[model samples]
Target: MTEDTLRSVNPATGELLAEWPIDDEASVTATVERARVVASFWRELGFDGRKQALLRWASYLVRNTDELTELIHKENGKPAEDAYLELMLVLEHIDWAAKNAKRALAPKRVSPGPFMANHEAVVEHPPLGVVGVIGPWNYPIYTPTGSVAYALAAGNTVVFKPSEYTTSIGVWYARSFALANPQLPGGILTAVTGFGATGAALVTSGVDKIAFTGSTPTGKRIMAAAAETLTPVLLECGGKDAAIVAHDADVSAAADAIAWAAMANSGQTCVGTERVYVDETVYDRFLAELKSKLDNLKPGSGADASYGPMTMPKQIDLVREHIADALERGGRALVGGLESVGDRFIGPVVLIDTPEDSRAVTEETFGPTLTVRKVKSVDEAVELTNASEFGLASTVFSKSHGMEIGRRLRVGATSINAPLSFGAISALPFGGTGASGIGRIHGEEGLREFTRTHSFARQRFAIPGMALLSFGRKASTVAVIRRVIGLKHGRHS
Candidate 1:
């Protein structure tokens, strides 16, 4: 990246994909102002109007899926199938948000207390005006659209700053929305491209809210910057995610799912499995099955590639550092080792007996690697899995106790007897409890996250002599109320 321009390159072959003039603070401010100008128009669109526009955008993307997927494959270096699947997830979310927005954010009546029986109360979810979304590159379309779709469905305009690595895809995303709805105002959805300065500019650009999906440290920095304006933020950050393979589990099925979960997208997923705790009774069998499944997988830019290269070239060094750290700390690798870390792609590296505190076991590796450990029982597995500072997502496998085990896990989303099922379900809210993230995306919780709770109280009628809200309160009314209150409270004990 030069000082004046940002470049996007394919990690698979170092092929230059696209370039753009960087969006600096001044330009970002202008973009935000444009979005802010249309804020009221978007909010006033109401549920039905906005839903139509959002659905059109979804349909447009569906029609142009081939173009977007090819771009994703070229820009982010994921296999074409994976790129298509990511687009499919984005469409599902957009459809869900459009169809469910009314139900999730509409005004609802609330019962007034006994003392205010003559009054009626109601609660409503109002859009937070313009929302600034800083997206990630791993699942650029699926992840950021999680924020963009929901925020727009809830009536908030969005100024999205996609990752520098996937800037063109981000541009395509915003442009697609505009193309889908040419009748709508321009600022309802827009894109600003650049690196850190561009994103930081958006954070401080006075947007009503910022929905960021990125690294934990970057999330902390964005949160701190947003704090200066007391701007509300929804942070979906890093994860050192773990999975448990139980003694009673189907070893074959668990192995297949965990292999994909750990290595897909070159393991750039925030909720992807990085660590595994296998029941000691089936540790050997599980390890063998897992290794067998991964043996058939390969990383390339080809259609048959198990996955593709790491989207960010710099992240390769970090993966190497983790591998070196684990090997030096007495861990043994069953698959690839330090030598597997290549210029573009790192093959699947599976480590066993890595110390619990080793960087490979504790940190967010963000690469195609796995750390497997054996635990005495499911109880021990749960304990070990929850020990990570990142409580983002996890998978549990047990024939009869999958749900039971999942409930005991500390992560925000848990997949029982499956891998990444939580992510596939549009109705499920996804987020973490600790260093993983701040708030949720996807589902009703996600819809409401971009809105503010507004309460309203209306007086139906005023009692002839009871003017409690007015300055004309009477001693007689107070006496009667005290007697009734005492009687009502005295019955509880």
Candidate 2:
């Protein structure tokens, strides 16, 4: 039997905000089948037609920003202003997907190669039938929309399953899109509500691809389940991203950027700065500046606070555990420490002298916490930063060698002199390496992730004397081909 209702509650006050009927096995299968049928009509619309429909949906989001912002605040406990910013960024991504999809996915001619010079070749990208998206509650609109918008732009239908805690927000996304484009088929963009079992159903429900965002362990489970059907998956797992400060970095600017990145959204971000490496030349100055900034920051349920309560209650315990491990291993808190982790609202924390082997230094704390370590040089900083298996995104602040140093990071995205700036630009792809997950979302790479490509070639004419592809060629033709290959490639070796 299907579960009755999935309740969405406010993490801060434990208030039940809304309830949605959980989609069971039968419902989930039906939804996928419906999407498969609707995908034909969606693909027939072509890029320009789909672009218009997506633009209308973007307009709907803009018009209802206030309502959506409130829902996000209630569901995820982020500050209203932060929630609004997230909505605006999603709008930007939608616009990019709409305007660039046709150009990016359009068929293009390619040279046929030397042996088949008389042939014409072309490559085309086609939409995968239906895409399944499993979203996270943190930045619900922005994160899921990254997959949804690109999938729609690429002429594929979408079946979105948002985090259980933000089920209503997911419903609002689908409802708003439908209202904006009433002519669109119902299953072109659908939302299913449920827990982990529902997501498992989607993975095996015959979808072409799945885009998931959450913890590394959960990502592993999803991948294993998808492996049953050989279904391709794009896993945007979380990160223990690092921030490196060079000796030449602007002490104040670096401190401010790190502080904001660490504390924003209560540090529920996948690419947020969790560990920091500062060169010894400016280590003390950076810490002093960072501590000063953290002192003014406060976490609370009110909108006036710098950040709100933790969106996931269990994350608080993880934060406390990591901090305890660091402290027990000779780490000292320069700012708020173990006591700062409240029941829901976790205050800002800045730790120094944390051992390299400490949990705080190695794990994805996923909280408003920062572990700073002093390094002798930028190379040491890079080596230390790359120590973790989680390589999602990283940041570096340097005056003359910012880009040079950032290139050393083994992350999917890196920001120079900025914190998590890679996530703002719709043109830059976002994801991670190693345990941070695989595949990419956002930008041109994102549009391609939801589609497959096919290449075709046709012979315009045949050379009268050339029978190289057949056995009819003379022995001299083989000699001539050998000489040609020798002349072309012999010098390279």
Q: What is the C-alpha RMSD of each candidate to the true structure, in Å?
A: 1.1, 1.4
- Listed in order, each prediction's TM-score against the native is 0.98, 0.98
- Candidate 2's TM-score reads 0.98
- Ten contiguous residues with the weakest lDDT in model 1: 462-471
Off by over 4 Å in 2: 1-3, 471-473
**Cα deviation in Å at residue 110, candidate 2?**
1.1
lDDT of each: 0.92, 0.91
Clashing residue pairs, backbone N/CA/C < 3 A, model 1:
none
Candidate 2 lDDT: 0.91
Find the number of clashing residue pairs for candidate 1: 0
Model 1 lDDT at residue 466:
80
Candidate 1: global Cα-lDDT? 0.92
Question: What is model 1's C-alpha RMSD?
Answer: 1.1
Model 1 regions lying over 4 Å from their true place: none
Tens digit per residue, CA lDDT, model 2, 74-182: 8888889999999989999999999999999999999998978999999999999999999998889999988999999999999999998789889999888899999
